[model samples]
Target: MTNLWSPITLGGITLPHRLAMAPMTRSRAKPDGTPGDLAPEYYAQRASLGLLISEGTQPSEDGQGYLATPGIYTDAHVAGWRKVADAVHAADGRLFIQLMHVGRRSHPDNTPHHRQPVAPSAIASGDSMFTMSGMQPVPQPRALETEEVQQTIADLAYAAKRAIDAGADGVEIHGANGYLVHQFLAPDSNHRTDEYGGTMKNRARFAIDVVRAVVDAIGPQKTAIRLSPGVATGGIAEGQDNDDLYRYLAVELGTLGLAYLHILYARNDPLLEDVRRSFGGPLVLNRPGRSRQQIGADVSAGLADIEALGVMALANPDLVQRLKTGAPLNDVRSALFYAGGGAEGYTDYPAIGIV
Candidate 1:
């Protein structure tokens, strides 16, 4: 049985454990999208995890979805990320920066330019987003022109390069959770008739192009992608051919020889078995409702190479120790998660023995 404590290799880098720190948005970046000084300490505190994937960071101005989310396209952003990378590396940790483009899941007030959101089509997500003025409705986004689709892919590649230049071990393209790449994947959200849409292969083209571009910019060994086939977050209702869409995507992306594929899994998701068979590289499984005792169940069952934890890692800096020792986990104060407090619930989470 592959236990959570056992070592594993991903992208040629060996991890001491199978527990990976999943990315969670803390909204701690500055108004300018540069990560704050506290960000390094926050991540370094949980460096014991096999892999630490940073919060979703915008790859371009139009990619910004929420206020205070970080960006990876500028010098300031690179400098800020370098501190985080150095800190995590000092503790012998590996880090991957998650490149996220929120697509139409944005309000004008939330962006630095106050620009309208863009997506595969001009449809609104019928959702509201948190802005400086509180929550507001997400307006219908302008559809990206055929030529602009390539530009968006270029932006993602540039951001991946910037992350690597900033000292990150690699970058994970966020294709899940109704983001830009995902918006293009789901038929309901992407109603385009161009080369980038309509057919399942066309819908998967943008994501594959973006991945190939990122792999070119930063070697395939340092590239990865996260996919959520069954998720409908941000009001995205997938079409009837959702299974076929992902099956095509998984097999296509799996052929790229990338580092690993991280999946957000749910109970009895049939696509799990398909994706497992199609994708030949390392697979990291993230079960939404998994308890500590079941951390390594997927790995023990040979279904996953690593177990990725979100809330457990957020609330417990020493999550590995707590899971191993069967110690109580600190309760997560969800309110403080995105409250912008530098040290409140961010870095103040104590390990097992603190008083």
Candidate 2:
């Protein structure tokens, strides 16, 4: 029987267990977009997990959206991430840096240069985001010209290489969460008549191109991507072809021989089976709000090869040990998740058997 504690290999790296730490945006970086000192300790604390995916790190200045989130495109940022990579590796943990671009779901106040956000089309998320000042409306983003689109693809490739240089075992493209890639996939958000919009293949073009670029820069075996098909976050609506779009994406991305494809969804979704069959590679499923008892159900059922957890990994540094002993999980303070405090809610979460 497949168990959560069973060993597995991902992208040629052997893991002690099959539970991975899902990436969460903690807003813990410095104002300059470099990871703070506490970032290393925070990640190393949870190194007991089989793998740890870092928070949504921007690939470029314009890719940023929230306050204090880290970037991977600069020298200082690379230096900062090296510390994190060292810490996690010292604790015998594998890490993958997630590259996220918020696109239209951004406010100028939240960006370093106060630059206008860019998206697949000239449209706002029609939502607001948390800024240092307070909640601010997301302004309409400028649509990327064809040339600019190519540059954005190049930017992702460069960032992936930077992550490797910073000592990350791999990189996961943040194509989920209604970010830049999802914006292009969702019909309601992408209205361009150009080659990048209109048809399913065209809509899938940007994501495929970005993934190809990253894979080319940092071998396919060390590259991965996270995708959410039906999610409507950030004013995104997939319309009718959600399944077809993902089917095409699964097939296209599957051909690249990526490390793995991470899906954020409930296990009960029928599309899960479709995606699993379509991808034909190691699959990681992130099913939120699961109890300890349900941890390995997907793996045992042959639905997924690994399970990713967010709050559980965040609150329990020795999560694998706790799960083994069936220890009660520590509660997480939701209010402190994005508070940007040093170690109060970041690394202060005690492990099992600790006072």
**Candidate 1 regions off by >4 Å?**
none
What candidate 2 gets wrong by more than 4 Å, as runs, is 266-268
Give the count of colliding residue pairs in each prediction. Answer: 0, 0
Where is the poorest 10-residue window by lDDT in model 1?
265-274
- Clash pairs for candidate 1: none
Q: Per-residue lDDT of 1-355 in model 2, one digit per residue for the tens?
A: 7877779888879999888999999998988999998999999999989699999999998899999899999999999999999999999999999999988888899898898999999988889888878888899999999899999999999999999999999999999888999998889889988899999999999999999999899999899999988876899866445778998899999999999999998433678888889899899999888888888888898888999999888888888888888788898888889886578888999887788
Per-model lDDT: 0.90, 0.90
lDDT over C-alpha atoms for residue 270 of model 2: 72
Candidate 2, 157: how far from true, in Å?
0.4
TM-score of each: 0.98, 0.98
lDDT of 1 by residue, 1-355 (tens): 7776889889978999888999899998988899988999989989999699999999999999988899999999999999999999998899999999999998889888888899999999999888777888899999999988999999999999999999999999999988999999998899999999988899999999999999999999999999988787877867445878888888998889999999987544568888878988899888887887688889988888988999999999998888778899999899998996479989998887796
Q: What is the C-alpha RMSD of each candidate to the true structure, in Å?
A: 1.1, 1.1
Indicate the TM-score of model 1.
0.98
Per-residue error at 114 for model 2, in Å? 0.6
Residue 17 of candidate 1: its Cα lDDT? 86
